[model samples]
Target: MSMPTLSAQEISSGRVVLRKAHDADRSGIIELFTDPVVRTYLGGPRPRRDVESHLDTSGIENATAKPGSYVIARNGTDRLIGTLMLARRPADRPGHVTDDRDELELSYTLRREEWGAGLAFEAAMAALRAAAAELPDQPILVVTQTANQRSLALSDRLGFRHVCVFEEFGAQQSLSVARLHSFAS
Candidate 1:
């Protein structure tokens, strides 16, 4: 079976905009991933050399072409402060709102400097709106480390309720869901 493709979408929420990653965002995304504190809950920060090399290859174009993957920019600037990803959860994965493999999974990461400024929530809310518009009736799932209080709180504020908590990647992972609306189409 072939994978379905999602149409690219752009959303704006005041000074923050959710749009596709551009070539200019390549360096910023690399910087976002390489920050030690930013990657703490994530596996870990990748080596600068490795990240740079990946960007030099196919990272930018691939990211841009994929739908539901966005670079969060501020004030219409090319400087990306974070990223949002909405993807289908792998059927093999532990968390699932249903038996379907196409459930939408929401993930995001922002620069440390943007922390406590509510930028992550802004960007994510925009992405959620777009997801609701495109994939209505389908629930959005956010999986994060339970120990990451900020992320957990953000998920809660975004109206995502805890579905379950389990250990994954040697850390406690919280699987949350938000069923914003139902699409009748």
Candidate 2:
């Protein structure tokens, strides 16, 4: 089944426009991943071919088949300032009976220059809003290296509670999770 196309808005921050990524955003996305500061938190600069592969594999057409994903704040000029992904929990092992599909994993990276500008928080909040509306019943999660102070701070600011610590990708990591409760009433 095809997913609905998400609408992108020009979110204003004084004079900046934080919107979604588009077809012409490849080069800007590549630059964000290649920056040293960004690579420090995320493993390393992913190979160019690998990035190209990701773009091809996770395009808008595949958004519904998997958990939704998006690029960072874009302007009317079509510049990419960050990236984010929300993936559904994987299926259980063959013999395991416990599988929670109502959970999603999130990861994001922003241009080094944009650090501390609140763009990351803005982008994350946008994703959370979209997910709550589009994928109800699922809680959102963010796992980061324990030493990644920036991400840990962002998680705390966004209301993700620390749940556990685990080792993964050869590094000690903290797993945080949060529920999306409706406060509309």
Candidate 3:
């Protein structure tokens, strides 16, 4: 059978909803890559013109084109606040929990204004729970830059244990792991 997945699934929780990107999310998705604070650990913000150059309505939904890709928005509205992804760690990427396979990786980013309200954590938990409920039991990974204390703290709060440190994107990074089964009800 094909692997169980969150591919194109619309998931929601009390405060956040993880849904496919849409036309209304274009500006928010652009802001995610162009805003300085939001892209601080993500190779710094791309030039706004450069970021805007490649996007069109079709490109917005490109964020959710694959299984596990989602635009994080408020529960009752389409306004985008952030992005969350529960997908494979590319084999070419530095961090991996398994030798022969690309492990599921959790990555997220939120609008700076929404940072202190626990929205990132809320969005992540919602995605993780959804993935765990559908996918096979396996190790999920969280790789964050060492300088990003906020992300590392969030990983801890989500129950991932630090595994190692490695260099990526010109900086030291930390890798952590949590089993998929742990999130299942």
Candidate 4:
């Protein structure tokens, strides 16, 4: 299904709201990629200058132009604290649940300050439930570095069972999946 049908209100629940990103979010967006704490398991933080350069070229305004990319924000504010993205896992990537590649993938990252509050869990659950309700039953994958115990735990909390572990990015990466139908309303 297309992204247009999924509105910010649809994925929003309780204290958190997931909405498309914008230029006003430049610093927050940059922080997600540059903050050492947030990027520890994601290949480390990129240089801030390079990140700014890329964002300038791509235009943060164009980010939400695609489907399933959201800024994780508090319910009463527009300030962005993190990002939750659902996108196609390219066929050429190291992980896959089906013989065919390009399965739906869920990835999220929150600012350091938001850790331990269960905000990531809350935002992710809301987004996945929304996706499950709107899309057909299929395997949705969550691939994370095996060394990331927190992420592995979160995957389990989200009902994804580990299927296999493979080498990627010079480290062992675990692939887990949850059936989309199981989450449908």
Candidate 5:
């Protein structure tokens, strides 16, 4: 079965569109993840096969089986400029078993040329707003490498408070979590 492509509203800046990713977007998505700067923060380049496999796994056809995730900052021509993923922890996981619906993890990336333009911040805020409307009681969490000042700053500007710093993938990193209740209200 094919996944449905969801259309997201334009953020205040109006330069970006957060929408469901299509299987055809696999190549673009792979480029976004493969950029050296992006890899610096995201860990490293995913093996080509791994990226291919994940794109297949994340195809829109699987929407009903998973939390909402999307390609962010799609241009007017529908080119993917960035990506955002929002998902509740799996029900079988320890965290989800306690509070499944009220919390979600957020991950995003944008082309280097798009950085410093506030597009990432705009997209993230818009996503949070959408999530708040769709899941009013849920909170959003953003985890990133401590060295990723760009993302960390964006998170802070968007109201994500610092929660902790820990090691992930064998590297010391910062973990920030935010509650969306205030934004919703």
Candidate 6:
């Protein structure tokens, strides 16, 4: 099912605005996905050539039409810093917390230069707020590599409780969940 587009202003925090990705953001997206430091926890960086080829062909419209996908950009300059998504966990995936087996999952990544400034946290909270509005009582999940300290810490800060640990892609993954009540605050 297709998701609605979010109003950038409605979900913005102090410095970050959550909105759809644009053609102009391709370069930034390419940069974020190709940076070794940024991709360290999410899987190693993709080849620059590969990223270029994909962006050059598939484009941003396909990526933005999905319900909860967003670009985390600076408010005034509108500089792309990261991406955030609250999507359904595939029924076939390892983490299944609800009977439907399609629980919402929160995923985010910030450019390396944007790290240490809380943009990820701010953008994530904004995205979760938007998700809570649509999903109401449904819980949102996040799966991160156990070794990704930054993401683990962010999940804790966002009030996601650890559900379980399982292996995926040859690495230990921590599946965490945050209920609607947690987002109420």
Q: Rate the local accuracy (lDDT) of all candidates.
A: 0.79, 0.64, 0.86, 0.84, 0.67, 0.82
- Give the lDDT of residue 113 in candidate 3: 85
Best by lDDT: 3
lDDT for each residue of candidate 5 in 96-164, tens digit (9 for 90 to 100): 212433357777888777788888877777777776665655456777888889889988998888877
Evaluate residue 90 in candidate 6 and report its C-alpha lDDT on the 0 to 100 scale.
82
Per candidate, the number of residue pairs that clash is: 0, 2, 0, 0, 3, 0
RMSD of each: 2.6, 5.0, 1.8, 2.3, 5.1, 2.3
User: In candidate 2, which residue ranges exceed 4 Å CA deviation?
Assistant: 1-23, 48-67, 91-102, 182-185
Q: Please, what are the lDDT tens digits per residue for candidate 2 over residues 1-185? A: 22232233333433234455566676777677666678886787877787778878887333223335566655455567777766654444111112443356767888888888887887777666665655444456788999999999999998888987877677888878887543011
- Tens digit per residue, CA lDDT, model 1, 1-185: 32332355677887788778778887788888798999999998999998888888877867656766788889666578888887777888777777665577888888888889989888887777666665546677889998899999999988899999988899889999988463221
Could you estimate the TM-score for every candidate? 0.90, 0.73, 0.94, 0.92, 0.76, 0.91
How well is each residue in 24-100 modelled by candidate 4, as lDDT tens digits?
89999899899998899999999999999988999996656667878898888868888888878878888997777
Q: lDDT per residue, candidate 3, 1-185, as tens digits? A: 12445764688898999988887887888889998888889899998887677775347667788888898999876679999988887788898877755788899999888898899998888888888888889899999999999999999999999999999989999999999889886
Model 6, 62: alpha-carbon shift in Å? 2.7
The global Cα lDDT (0 to 1) of model 5 is 0.67
Q: Is candidate 4 or candidate 6 better by lDDT?
A: 4
- Model 3: residue 103 alpha-carbon error in angstroms: 0.3
Candidate 4 has an lDDT of 0.84
lDDT agreement of model 3 with the native? 0.86
User: What ranking of all candidate models by TM-score puts the best one first?
Assistant: 3, 4, 6, 1, 5, 2
Q: Which parts of model 4 have CA positions greater than 4 angstroms off?
A: 1-10
